[model samples]
Target: TQGDSGIQRKGIILGKELARSLGAYTGDLLAMMSPSVRMTPLGIIPKIKMVEVVGIFESKMYEYDSNLAFISLSSAQSLFGMKNRVSGIEIKVDDIDAAGHIAVVIQKKLGAPYFARGWMQMNKNLFSALKLEKITMFIILILIILVAAFNIISTLFMVVMDKAKDIAILKSMGATRASIMKIFSMQGLIIGVCGTALGCLAGFTIVPNLNKIVGFIEQLFDIEAFPSDVYYLDELPSQIQYFDSFLIIVFSILICFLASLYPAWRASRLDPVEGLRYE
Candidate 1:
């Protein structure tokens, strides 16, 4: 089980940019020195080690990109002056979905003095907060979509009014109430699909690059970049999953259908004689 993956220094990985910033590269000599905290007659001491940078990787994440610095496992052991001992082992499972099951299995197998951790366990709080925020934002923005769907309802209602005579004649000719309802419902659905498609396109395509877009806007408007300090990240980060888009479309369709239902029912139930008499 001790393959290339098990090799690490100070129980961490080194990212490429960080390694470069530290004036180190792969297979090069680098030193990690930890300062001693003590008030003694002899004064403070330092723990240092000459280590080799085995690999340099680049993770897109800002934290990892800026913070990761590497040293070999053997160097870490020698630096800490701990022989035949390791802080912990990091494992990547084949299936992330089965992380809990695999962790339990590994725990049972390894028993005491060993443990397994999954990505969720490491950043559970962060991921949970992200999910909650995404849900909240989605719900909030969906009001805009709902407002757009209402336009469909308004359009279909006006269409019903304009074609009242046609509706009455159709009713007299035995056109079922359900059929009349279907016509209006279909009109609402078409509008809903169009609006939702436009919204999703704008959200997914443009929102991800919100920072660049905002930069362009700032240039146009002659303003600063919207006070970047407010955001935890320098730029907006949006990951529009297909699943989210699919749900957006489904919800839009449902809203449109619901919006059309009441008006459609009213139009269908109108008395043909009375409706014709009005005209």
Candidate 2:
């Protein structure tokens, strides 16, 4: 997080871990070596320069904090024997998902040696794994929804069995079969709607605080959920997609509606005289 002084000629800003390992701090001088070797009068030796430590930064990411450094473009160019040019440039865009398309457009517009590489291309494997994880999670959610739908079906069947005589009486009183079906179907829809609403409410309440929840679990169990060396992130991150939520609601209600049909049809087809006699 350190920054105020500029990285000037032979001045470098180092990662905190790097600084700690070297016991170097601001205003300290250190020798920086270039990988390329130059033919010296004595022998072939690597180019080296005395660089001043301008600042030390902490990023909380192990790879960056341990291995990264910052220097002025001119100093870097001179040190690397690039004279006046840089090998690459980094550009940030608003929509990361459209990065590949944007990169293609950039390449088309600025032809020749100019090229563009997006974050997606740079981290393709990571995103692919994340996409697979998302698919698996959705599959599990669908299975859970199906189990809930089965519960609704079993509950409605029990209700139908308990209310057989009432249903028979209603039939005798000239209630239409469709009317009976609608009543039971509406009941199932209500159950589905309530359950979905509660689930969504809980999700909304929990998601924003998920990191805190994970932290608590980690502390209680003495475990590391996001070890710095193992995971790229320091904590869990969550984003709620409204479209996905809407789709889940629709799917759940449709399943419940379908589950209600068989029980309602059975109730509709019961013989009034037999139902009454059995009761």
Candidate 3:
């Protein structure tokens, strides 16, 4: 309706981007060639038909917008000289997440001659690549946490050395080696807990406002950090999953606990006499 007044018997609809690129408008006639051949005086030639443009649609996705075209099923069949036959059927499901399951059921019902495929099956390679990329990024980020854990280990070891004299006095006052170990381990655990909480807080606060932050930085520097034309999006997109955040916090704390092991063991094994030799 937006293009031509109504869908004519041989009407075709063009994607918005395709229409723009071809400088075509509603009520304009476009010629399309079919793969089937027609015999003519000169020789065999491809079948051709001139169809009126009835509508233009926008899908937002660049690939689909620039490439897809549509026409009535009957018109399509007639153009290809396959009257009364359809190449495929499109089905809409209420639950998109169960599309694969539904596709399986459809295939089972259709049996031998027909097959059904879900969108996920149709784009398997793209999803697999995305999954691999996610795994690689996760491993890389985990390395950063490991590096921080090492820093924590060094800091705790320094603290243990500085408090050696106090530890010796505590031991002389009847503090057990187990109690000394517990003290150092608890101190390390407290540090890990605090660091994890702060990191989570900062992540939650920053991720949602990342686009705004980038915009501010761009304004300050007078440069575009992410150009809309190149990226095909007006702003950067980010999502914070609670489950992922929980896993990160757990992993960081686990690493910190492991890092504290050597330092805590060394502090607990310190002999009172050796620790207080110069005191």
26-93, model 3: which lDDT tens digit per residue?
A: 88999999999999999999989898889987765556667888887787888899999988988999
lDDT tens digits, residues 16-107, model 2? 87788899988899999999889979999999989988888888776788799998898888889999788998888898889899999999
Better lDDT candidate (1, 3): 3
Model 2: ten consecutive residues of lowest lDDT: 1-10
TM-score of 2: 0.86
Question: In TM-score terms, which candidate is top?
Answer: 2
Off by over 4 Å in 3: 1-11, 24-29, 42-45, 51-56, 210-237
In model 2, the clashing pairs are 1-58
Q: What are the Cα lDDT values of the candidates?
A: 0.74, 0.87, 0.87
Per-residue error for 4 in candidate 2, Å, reads: 3.2
The 10-residue segment with the lowest total lDDT in model 1: 1-10
What shift in Å separates residue 237 of candidate 2 from its native position after superposition?
1.5
TM-score of 1: 0.68
- The C-alpha TM-scores of every prediction are 0.68, 0.86, 0.80
Q: Model 1 segments beyond 4 Å from truth?
A: 1-31, 35-41, 50-56, 165-179, 196-244, 272-279
